[model samples]
Target chain A: MTVKLYRYLEDAAGRWPDKIAVQEVDGSFITYRELDRLSDRMRDRLVELGIRPGDRVGFWIRKSIDAVATIFGVLKAGAAYVPMDPTAPPTRNNYILADCGVAVIVIENRFEPMLIAEPSAQGAYPAILVIGGAGGGVHLRAMLDEKDRHAEAPSAVSAPVRPEDLAFVLYTSGSTGRPKGVQLSHLNAVSFVEWCAEIFALLPTDRFSSHAPFHFDLSVFDIFSAAKHGGTLVLIGEEVGKQPLELAHLIADLEITIWYSAPSILSLMAQFGELESRNFSSLRFVLFAGEVFPVAHLRSLVKYWPHPRYFNLYGPTETNVCTFYEVPTPIPEDRTEPMPIGKVCSHLEGILIDADGRAVEKGTEGELCIRGSGVTRGYWNLPEQSRKCFVEVAGATYYRTGDIAKEEPSGNLRYLGRSDRMIKKRGFRVELGEIEVCLYRHTGVREAAVVALADDTLGMRVHAHVVSKDGRTLSLIEMKTFCSEHIPIYMIPDRFSFHPSLPKTSTDKVDYQTLKFWSGG
Target chain B: MTHESSAMSIVKEFILDEFLPGEEPSRLTPTTALVSTGILDSLATLKLVTFLEQTFDIQVKAHEADEEHLNTLHTICELVDSKR
Candidate 1:
């Protein structure tokens, strides 16, 4: 059966026209009919702007009802949506816009100043649709006002959006310092969305809490799965999500039934949010991904919200949650190691291959490789990097997830850290090579090594060890200032140490193990 | 010491000892912007919040843990006093 991603929104709106489709933390709600009508107008406007099939549309807005509407509208217009984090450094946002060759950008007026100040903003796109006020671009309100002049909703476009067409592109850090966009097709997203609907057994009565940012892959399930099942999606704003206590209260106050976020956020709530005192009777499921939840913290979370079904999902953004493990009710006391990521989803297949390209036997450690409908098409423009990761294995194309894993006898996969320099900090996949490249941009830095120092609370903190040039000195203030200008605030190293020279391995490469140890010292 | 005065001292000591180790305690005052100045990032702010909750026996609501409430030494002391 042919499927388009927008069909989820259309089907839900048809089934439950008056149901609350999306809700913001500030008590704003959009009914299914309103969501449908607004997105239809947006789709007409996009088509009018010459956004054709297979074109890329970008969004740099915060989580709001308009953001959700824009996503569905882009899909309906037969173009893929690219979401850039509004809080990301302007440099990063501009790079993504240029890299994707976005045909149009939908941005909020508050973000217009940052966009205008970006050096890469000059002629980056042909058009910009400002969400709030008039700002050097087409005002979205004007477009909707023009549409309102017509008595009926605009007729659906005849643009052919096949299942294999691009749906959205999510950018993740690459080892080469430039962010690479992972392209997911309509089929890829729909497979996961359908599987989620089946597994979660969602209904119109369910209320889904969306805690991940719009740019994060976790939001894909939060948006599409809820839309597909006709469930109300309550968006937890970034500021609210940051406050563990506020987030806990939101869950309780909204009676959110299905909750999804990073383990670090849940850990904070369990530790500091007084979760035990809250009533989560309406909460039925708690889903976490991006990083391994420390078993101790997981146990504590269970103690507080024991009635909810807890699941640990595992996958990079490329595959959008291919594996999951349901935390057994009454977690065993002797469980010491981090929770297992469990078996592959019903719609996907996973394999563990050793260093020599041979499939390792069960219980042997090897790189996790996934091949299935959920796997993304590949990186947006980097063919070389895409070819390196997406390879043909036994005649089937597989995305080589650089993660190391071992399969248990019970068919569960135990995650052993990454095989490369990529680490998850605060549920964000960070490439150490990316930070090293930023450090090298400084003239006074000769060598730089970045490592992750694991923390129970923050998941992991980045520490940078650098070697100064022959006659230069480096200060924390200077280094931080330079990094903040080039990268996102989250990617900035938490701690910095300067040395005359870095420890080198026998192969003459920087000894990251030594740096990690020295960081402890 | 008065409750507010002791709370301020506790916050000051923690900031000096944890974030600005070995630095002169006089470097920071009640109105210094710890967050905007990059002295405390997201993780550090969380750490500071946990410290405040434990040391002052006050609950720093997640919303109150942001820059508006905890950016300065004085604001942090005020948050603690209000919660207490």
Candidate 2:
């Protein structure tokens, strides 16, 4: 239990001091020795800034090599890192920062305005470490550049941390008006990372692609897998990552041996990335998760890159990849149904139960619950929410997945549907109720209902229906601008419809089935 | 209006209709950074590309659909014209 997540990097540094640790594609590369030294210096700077053990440190900067080092640096300081989406609305970011009460924040200078909106009530704002030519704040470059500062760093060891200590917190959409932070301990994450290393047979020679943002749970696998095995992680920035062609080229040029990202990205690369002319022979394993990949697009990817083994990873942020499906190569032409989320991962336990919380027979659909090493300790600062997530069945507690699933005779779990209003839009989990909550807060809005519909290009689309308090039609433009200033852009409704009244069920709840039918979903 | 001006108008209208519903068309200038300014995420970019392809009767290549070419309104116009 003494071994925490940061030990992987420390151990890797010892084994492969000269090997490349983290690289920015077509930009710069840092060796394991440099990363170790930089992280140690970063740890020293954080400790000097009064970041104590178990303190949460916020990272609001874009993904870069320095950010990678900063992650380990915070870990070495015996603190948990909380990452906020740099592109999210200022209000959303401020809410998360205020909710977590982070001791310090690392941000790019350009976002000073966004941080300015934070309410000045929390006993002095978090100390800032700005990345770009720090103005009135400590320079992040000072932590990475070791020429003069390394001599100033203290040789004192940081406080000891246990495996159960907090490692990182990831915030996901909540049914309430605000987002909820999912707290994962070092044990929670280290166990999942170790399981991936074992299941994937990760090697020191493998080159992993860091496609997901650090705030996402998906990024945990990319960073720790490389650290644990002394592999190289090539960080892909947002600009290149958003461009299908550039990302496809990066996979080839960087010689990414292991490619892990959402199925949306893979589908994009397959559709418009000009994959026919691209080279993907270096890809040894390709993994996709978060949302279902349409079989057609997945088939096209298989056609072009038939060399790499494809895997479908399934899990929520609460449990890091509890189950996964290994796609059979050369998908049979007539296979219409998408592959099932395969057997539960060896490290975790899955249970399917009915609405009454009783175990269901095989082939009967029920909610999927997971328990074991990867299940998080709970949500940050929300004891009630945490306690509600667990239900004791037959004397063992399991975290409810909120997903409906059927157990096939072959032991694989077939994902049927969701029991809640949650949906994944472009790999980001969004709760429709959250959008409704935002709309309800709008002045003169009497009622709001939101639903997600499947889309060919965008993975899924959000549609919102609203009723005006005065029965006057609401301006679509004003509504959109209102939403843009409040919620993250991804959660914004693609289209808004006005109705004097919405259809309701006998229980007086808005009928989402009617909405979905009207949407032709 | 000339065909060029008409093309500009059409593109502006589409941008307002899809991405920036309430924003003034004049504010979205030719030099505005569409992709970098957080207006056009990957989903928005795909929709814009489809609009350009279907409306302009041209095909946008993979490399042409990058930030370098699609970041600015001017660059997007240039990309569409070149494809035509």
Candidate 3:
């Protein structure tokens, strides 16, 4: 068995040297042999730049074929790659880089000023490698070309990376006014990928759709599944997300055989894509996760594209697709409740524990806990927070997902929403407190509270309550602009309710319940 | 004002008031890249569509609500005028 993910790519390159491995929306592609050589060049470049094993490397560029090269190259150099969301506010990305101690980052020329000017960019700056355009950093496009290498094809290079070494770090919404990095090792992800290959029966002929950003865990299944199976990865630009019809056309046009993304996207295509007019016969498996699949949308999608098998995958960033439920064929029309999360994956052991951390009996509601090779090591640089979520029971360490569920008579685990204030907005996990923290950063704000407004169409919309400084009333537009500069655009509040003072609970904490009640649920 | 320019001003005013509340008014010209620059997300685009439907009595088809037609104030006005 391969010790790291890059080795799988090496394995694939050895078999099918001329086969396409990754492709962009423009239809440009890189074959397995070319991808291997390019990644080796990237590894050689990083090594020349002093990137060492266990170091953190980040990429602030958009999703493309070169971005895939960066991932494999970083791993080949025994470093973990931190993929940043380019659309996210640069301040947050800078903070993430500083927090994770990124030794280097791959960025485009246009983003250099923002990264340098941001307040979070203080301290020792990470070396930047520019692609596409000129920046103050070294131009990376030169080395990516095969012309710089020897005439003869170079064999695949393997680093001294161990199985337990960190492979990647995903920054998620943290409760404490910032984002937390969820670190996963090669062993942690390999187990999940192997399980996925076995469960879905992945084939080299399958063309997996890559829609999610590299930062999202959903991309894990998309990127690795193709490399592991020696299949082609089709990149879909995020711009198509707003144009559901275009998204539908891309899926059909790309001939995507294996599809995976948040259910909201599938719902969007079904609601407005006019999918019946298009062809989706290429899809063999369609996996949706990150939020509940509204039955109405699922039914409409099936009505249009029924060729693919549907699966409801459930897990947090800390646990990679821990449980899944294959949607039963011909969903009953009268069914109102969403489908259960189904059984845990074969590689993991899941248990339900009470408020006191004791295991609960069958058919009883409890917090879902997973202990296995799939569970990721907790947040980077956050020992206290990691200690809290990852607890030991009977010598095996389990990750507390903070999700409530119960085992049904059919032996399936049914999801019962979040046990805490975390909510899914457009299939992305968000902490209400994280928004409040951003609002409080503004000097114009005195007190701030955030609550979620659940909407069927967009998963959930954020509603914020604020009391401005010195009795001044803050305009909704000003708050929106301020929040947009500090947080992700998706995390922006849908509405702002100005208050002279916020109501408090009996314990003196801000009354989120009252605020939620005021939002009319 | 001419009908095209009148429609353009109304749409631009609505966008500034909604998506770019505190920004300078001169920034949102008729040719400004609203959708491409992410001044309008899907939800924001839907909101703009709702406002236009009620104000101008024009329906935006699912295909019409894409980057090509909805990317700028000029194209959006063209879409509104065409639908009308």
lDDT of 1 by residue, A157-238 (tens): 7357888899999998878899899999999999998888778898889899999998899999999888888999998776
Full-model lDDT for every candidate: 0.83, 0.84, 0.83
TM-score of the second chain of model 3 compared to its true counterpart: 0.95
Model 3 residue A119 lDDT score:
23
Identify the runs in model 3 with alpha carbons over 4 angstroms from their true place.
A117-125, A133-156, A470-473, B2-4, B12-40, B46-84
How displaced is residue B28 in candidate 3, in Å?
8.2
Whole-structure CA lDDT of model 3: 0.83
Report how far residue A517 has shifted in candidate 1, in Å: 1.6
Which lDDT tens digits does candidate 2 get at residues A1-521? 33588888888999999999988875578888888877888898888778888898998877877788888999999999998887678888888988888888888878877785343354667887767732111245553454344445564465588878898999999999789999998988988987887789999999999999888889999999999999999998766777887788889878999999988889889987788776788899999999888888899899999999999999999998999999998988888788899888888999998989988998999999999988988898899999988888888999999999998989899999899889997788999889999899899799999989888767888889888999877765567657877887678888777788988999999998998887777
Query: What is every candidate's alpha-carbon RMSD to the true fold?
Result: 3.9, 3.7, 4.1
Q: Write the per-residue lDDT of candidate 3 for residues A1-521, one digit (tens) a residue.
A: 67598888888899988999998777788889978877887887777667888988988877777788888989998899999888788889988888888888888767867785222234655777778742211234453453346342243455789888999999999889789999999988889999998899999999999988899999999989899999999987666655677788888888999888998888888887888888888999989999888888888788788668999999999998999999976677787788899999999999998888888999999999998888887899999999999766667778999999999999999999788888887667899889989999999989999998767777677888999888776755456667878888778877778789999999999988798898897
In the order shown, the chain A TM-scores of the predictions are 0.94, 0.94, 0.94
**Native A-B contact fraction in model 2:** 0.23
Question: What is the lDDT, from 0 to 100, of the residue B32 in candidate 3?
Answer: 67
Strongest candidate by lDDT? 2
- Clashing pairs in model 1, backbone N/Cα/C closer than 3 A: none
Listed for every candidate in order, the interface RMSD values in angstroms are 3.5, 4.7, 4.8
DockQ of each: 0.28, 0.30, 0.25
Candidate 2's iRMSD: 4.7
